[model samples]
Target: MNLEISIIVPDRIFLRDNAHTIILPTLTGQMGVLTNHIPLLTGLDTGLILVRKSVSSDWIGVVVTGGFALVNDNKITILVNEAELGSEINAEEAEMAFLAAKSALENASDEKRKIEINSQFKKARARLVCFNSIV
Candidate 1:
């Protein structure tokens, strides 16, 4: 049997899985973890998570950002800061958010402001990517 997994952010359930592989958008980079994989914990990046179901070759994608994931007991639990899906994302809203973040980044005068704006900018861009993906 494949592992069971779930991914959630504060506002939504990103995914629930019985999968052969769970490709996480880790801060270090995209990493594919499979059943009986080593126990690990890592920070997630703002990028696509591609889940491969046990009997299928095709991968399903989700967007995850700013979180840590744990793998153990044939399960992977991801507690994300945020997550979004292609079908649920609104392009207009994402663009508007991107523009606002850009403006803030441009006008930011302090380190904290820069950091805040940058985080928003990345989140917006990741949403755009998820919404625009073909698969």
Candidate 2:
């Protein structure tokens, strides 16, 4: 059996599909969900979400900025602030962005700047992760 999964952002529904399993980047850590998994709700982190359609299928990667995931009755609804499919990201561009963000974070002079740059660095890292997962 497959689990029904829907990913939504403020502007539109990013994805709706059935998957054999899903690995979510939660605040606590990575959480794996399968069919008939226990019902729960959790806060998401800015990272990659891996979805496998079936045992023989390749995993699909998605970058999510942060949000909430709700699992109930073999269905998952993810509402995120921002989301992008890995396939849509340019690997070279993502790599460059990641490097730039990393450098900026390292050179940050103030606490506020550090915090802002840190978030960008994390998001860039997540994008890189998603891109690499698919490649």
Candidate 3:
């Protein structure tokens, strides 16, 4: 049985489809969901959401920033502040953003600014990684 996955962002829905499996970045670590997986509700980290369908068995990647994930009755729903599909990511632009965030993080003196910059850096880095994985 395939699992239905949906990723929702404030502005738009990033993905909605069926997949054999999904791997998501959780606060504790990466978690993989499959058919009949136990129900879960967890905080997400800035990282990649990997989806794999059984038909072709190719992985689709989506970079998502801080959010939450819910799994119930063979459906997975992800709610994120921001999400970008691997196909939509531009590697060069992502690299530039990553570098800029890194620089800002290094220069941030206040704890709050540093925290924000660090999150940016993580998101940018995840974007680059996910972009590279797309065929």
Clashing residue pairs, candidate 2? Answer: none
- Taking all chains together, each candidate's TM-score versus the true structure is 0.78, 0.97, 0.91
- Tens digits of per-residue lDDT, candidate 3, 1-135, equal 889998999988878999999999999999999899999999999999999998578899999988999999999999999888898888899889988988899999999999878888999889888988885
The total number of steric clashes, by the backbone 3 Å criterion, in model 3 comes to 0
Task: For candidate 3, give the lDDT.
Answer: 0.91
lDDT value, candidate 2, whole model: 0.95
Give the alpha carbon lDDT tens digit for every residue of 1-135 in model 1: 797889988977767868888788888788888789888888887777777786557666677768888998889999987776666778899778878888989999999989877877878777776676633
Query: Of the candidates shown, which would achieve the greatest lDDT relative to the real structure?
Result: 2
Descending-TM-score candidate ranking: 2, 3, 1
Model 3 misplaced stretches (Cα beyond 4 Å): none
User: In model 2, what is the error at residue 128, expressed in angstroms?
Assistant: 1.0
Candidate with better TM-score, 2 vs 3? 2
Count clashing residue pairs in model 1. 0
Top TM-score prediction, candidate number: 2
Give candidate 2's error at residue 131 in angstroms: 1.2
